[model samples]
Target: MENRKAIEAGQDITMQKEDFAALWKTIHLKVTDTYEVPPEILWVNGSTIGTLGNFSASTGKAKSKKTFNISAIVAAALKNDEVLKYSAYLPPNKRKILYVDTEQSKYHCHKVMERILRLAGLPTDKDRDDFVFIVLREQTPDKRKQIIGYMLENMPDVGLLIIDGIRDLMYDINSPSESTDLINLLMRWSSGYNLHIHTVLHLNKGDDNTRGHIGTELNNKAETVLQITKSQQDGNISEVKAMHIRDREFDPFAFRINDNALPEIVDGYVFQQPKQDRNFPLTELTEQQHRKALENGFGKQVVQGYSNVIAALKQGYASIGYERGRNVLVSLNKFLVNKRMIVKEGKGYRYNPDFHY
Candidate 1:
């Protein structure tokens, strides 16, 4: 019936699912079954930045030009061109992009649409069929989500979705149950539609972390968590860094809004690297080295807790005659976890043998 509504609304009925397997097949994984991987959507310097069937989040404090960065991304997708070093590619069947503005007024949403059009080298005076932008500020939280659901089901071949101000979809950002359900919805939507979703979130005041339990859940589950911060060296500039990514990290970059109200990359900006702690003989490991380390550390067993993870890795390092201190272990754990080589399971972490090299 839901699919009937979609078909009535002019969508192909092939995408209609009665419901996700509500029972046994949820846990079913068979070697004989073929699982198709989603194609990449965005990349930088040849490393993937976003892919279909996944979601990414970007966070910043108030007045941090979050929308400007997003404008560039939208332009990149619309033109299938490069914008500030981000290259985008979408299959012919899934070429449309949808933008949902939950916190902005109709006037503000119009300005953003114009900004995106100008950046994409399209006519700002007219709307393109491939780009759909809508504002949900007047709707209730439940209504906004329902509207998004309707869009997802009826909008034909939308490859990318941006939900600006995802917090507006819930009544309380701190509710653990709400946060969990929302995150789960994001995952299901992305995978079900074969699309990529990018979300915007705000940082907590007086702190660098994302706001509330929703932020925590996003940090743990998002495919990538990009943080936008005011440059320490130049407050006028905004820098983007990968707080966490499932792939290799990219070089942090900065951009400033220009006279045209479009974002321009800031070149030759010297970013200060973090200060190192106790010196380790080997501070970095290659991909193969990481795989070798994982083999030595886990030996096909789950290591419970942070302390155990550190101790196991220390032994793994010692076998290769390297010193593993607290700092190195901390950094290593974060790196491995972010790259998904080490997967968190409840209170423990286990080495995932399937981690791509």
Candidate 2:
């Protein structure tokens, strides 16, 4: 009643200055005294995609298997399994995954689900309440956003969310303001929920870049951006390259649909052959050679310096130049370090042979 009387008198309709300060003090922190260990919350192709509250994107041309790649990621996250020969963050309590497909018919989407289940090694007949798949081809732009917003708000356990057709969420991909707004919403949702969000985008038909202003904005804001492209050497193979990454980027890897119609990495696959010239940098070696060196180095199971590792690589292939060999050795060492296949020692590193590729 007293508060009502004060309001009726038209004195200070807004919150009082002292009350606002009290509310601010509840959440304020001392900058120098505050410290926190970053969360380990992202994984793709066995590499750390990023920490929590980060967004990543995958882009490809039509029929480039962009959806399939993301499906593999979803499978890994849900089953706490590996995908494309890479490990993922497997929480003690498996968290729910929400996959929203804005394009594709119901029939095609079901096939995607089957492929994901197969990759996760889960039976198709089993009940999967933890993984939710929503096909929203008919939903309006506004409606789709509303539904996604509701899910994010109500389902606190959803640790991973994949939007297959992220471009459809905005009415105009060419509009800078619209694209900025959509990305802002995604960034806000990701940070607010402490979740990782992956979105799929289509690349320009004639160019390697993603389509329109929206793609540009997404690339700018995303912590990791993967590019999927049909191999020029073979039509059956699709190459996935980490175009931009905040952390260490893995070498480009290729996959093809197996007899089971699932995406599987081709072991010993070489995306491209290096130019046959002594002048060519060792860094330009084929993906196969890189993997071979990495496997050989890790096979030793002993602490090895970079020079010794390069010597071992040259033993497998005599064509590697001294500088080129060192480059390859360093690259593979970084990759293995990031993948947790090896640990750095005093002026050397020890490889873990038991670590699965």
- Top lDDT prediction, candidate number: 1
lDDT per residue (tens digit) for residues 1-357 in model 2: 998998877765677889989988756888767655546556655467755577889999998878878877877776676778545673544288889999989999898988898889889887687888999999999999999999989888777888999999999888878988999999888888877888999989886656888876775578788888888888888888876676767778889988988899977877676343345344465656545655554455554666775565545444333334466555544455534455444335555443334
Alpha-carbon RMSD to native, per candidate: 7.9, 14.0
Q: List the residue pairs that clash in candidate 1.
A: none
Question: What does candidate 2 score on TM?
Answer: 0.69
Worst 10 residues of 2 by lDDT: 316-325
Top TM-score: which candidate number?
Answer: 1
Q: What digit string (tens of lDDT, one per residue) describes model 1 on residues 1-357?
A: 998887787754334354435543776788898977779998866678789999999899998888888888888999998887678987898899999999989998999999988988899777688999989999999999899889999976999999999999999998888988999999988988889999999999887768888887787788888888888788778988887777888888899888988889998988887665546523465676777777897888889978999998888766766657788888767667656677765457788777754
In candidate 2, position 57 carries an lDDT of 90
Q: Which residue pairs clash within candidate 2?
A: none
Task: Rate residue 147 of model 2 by lDDT.
Answer: 99
